[model samples]
Target: MNATPLVLAVLHPRVALFELGIAAELFGLARPELGVPWYRFETLVAGEAAAQAVGSLRLTSDGDMDAIDRADLIVIPGWSTDAAPPPAELCDALQRADARGARFMSICSGAFLLGHAGLLNGRRATTHWRHCERFAALFPQVRLDPDVLYVDEGRILTAAGSAAGIDAGLHLIAQDYGSAIANRVAQRMLVTPHRDGGQRQFIPAAYPQRRSQRFDAVLAWAEAHIAEPLSVATLARRATMSERSFLRRFQDATGLTPMSWLSQLRIGRARAMLESGDAQLEAIATACGYGSPESLRAAFRREVGLSPAAYRQRFRMRNAPGAAAITPP
Candidate 1:
């Protein structure tokens, strides 16, 4: 059996209900029969004695700042976009906890708390797309990727917005217990187990005015053949345009160049393969159009900041009780 990690969610006043719910659903739910131990989940309030969450949900905490000191994983759920900066005491507590090796994570606007706490400086992060421009301007040191669903930089992880919080929490579960357990939990919740953090946040459902149908057709084709080698010429041919024309139109439509979009798709596929844990690195590489394990490793490291083997080790499924399985490194 695997040991469960302790998870602590710190709630501020006027929290986003959905973000708080994602944390509760993933961590508060007990599933001891899956051969994984139960997570110790607690909701700790930072400021006021009691708070009203979105809807009719009222919340109170068991303790105050002291709770942050004992946490293994400290999560800050969504904070208000217009809210004042987090209190200095809260910021200090967060930094002190991080110095003690407690993993720190944030969802949506909660990322602002992390930024204020100094945990996000010099780290790549994401937040609600609407707030991204401001987030970038406010924190010049943090690299903000507005398109991704989430960014996990070792000890600190940040999610985009709203339901992206679920992806972030499930990712942490996968990291702690292995992909198999995370998948099972996701299955029980009826959610997609993995959406690569790099997926574009918004893709137009309908074509924009004056956009060419040729560009749309080429995009549909590219989505279908993600595992195939794609080049500007190949896409231009599919769209029946000159390479320069196709490049301009594609960028205007999708806000990304052909290769940039293709790389994101390939990385997303690679992440799915790593989470499944059944495929060999070479097989995953070929399936994702990387051609070889070495190529895949280089790409994975560049995009995810970790090797494919290390990713698989962190997210692969573990065998059930009584089954022979090598312990994860």
Candidate 2:
């Protein structure tokens, strides 16, 4: 995107103030304090109209919704596109823009707009949990996973709820800037750098840190020997502690039990192998100690919220710092 990335946030008569507010806080606001270049924000409304939100709060938007066709990032912050269908023209414009290659994101019910535009078809997506049943029923073709805070399907993304909007926003920032910058923004907002018990290792985060020297050393060793057997009992022995004591200490330090932490490390290794090379699934699974491709796929789906294949397609080679994807224009 030119010098400064253009983030176009969509507003409508039914937009949610909280969702829009978070988007503004993340990308719309100026942050010379960040000491780095940031997004140039804009807003678009269908037909260049102004209307009251929920029929009370007034919102004035400049320019036609078709302007999304030019935005580097298009955000449908929140809209009731399911109950009241978005205009045919607006939906068509979004589809055309997506085809021409722009990243799109939604928060809460805003996913309904992307679903309506057919951008969610065959794509993993989510909305607020309360609306999960309805969203799935309405968009049967969309692969709806109701549990994750957000689903980043390459250029098309969806978040679960109002507060998850903050998670998604911070995630986007981490994807664009580095985790250090993202953490600084989260500090300014007075929230955890990675929320909800932290995300996957493959998911961009503040990077791994050690809480204890001994435990960190054991962990470092285990990561290197991940291809071998790593039973919790074995790890406990390596840490020179009883299984019970080691379990408690490991969880306290990493927010995951010994076994769980090992699983995460294995999954992270598998992801790296998937991204950096063309190793066969069986080879990757065995090298990561998953035993088989099926086992790897199941764990990958549960932890990362997508099959290993899908994750590779979205992230392989394209995931450098500050850029998540590059769809052809």
Model 2, span 281-315: residue lDDT tens: 99999898887899999998877767888777755
lDDT of 1 by residue, 45-153 (tens): 7787776875778888877788888888888888766546788999999999989888977888999889888888899999987788788878889999887889999
Distance from true position, residue 107, model 2, in Å? 0.4
Clashing pairs in 2: none
lDDT of 2: 0.80
Candidate 2 stretches greater than 4 Å from native: 81-84, 197-329
TM-score for each predicted model, relative to the true structure: 0.61, 0.59
Worst 10 residues of 1 by lDDT: 201-210
Candidates' lDDT values, in order? Answer: 0.80, 0.80
TM-score of decoy 2: 0.59
**Best prediction by TM-score:** 1
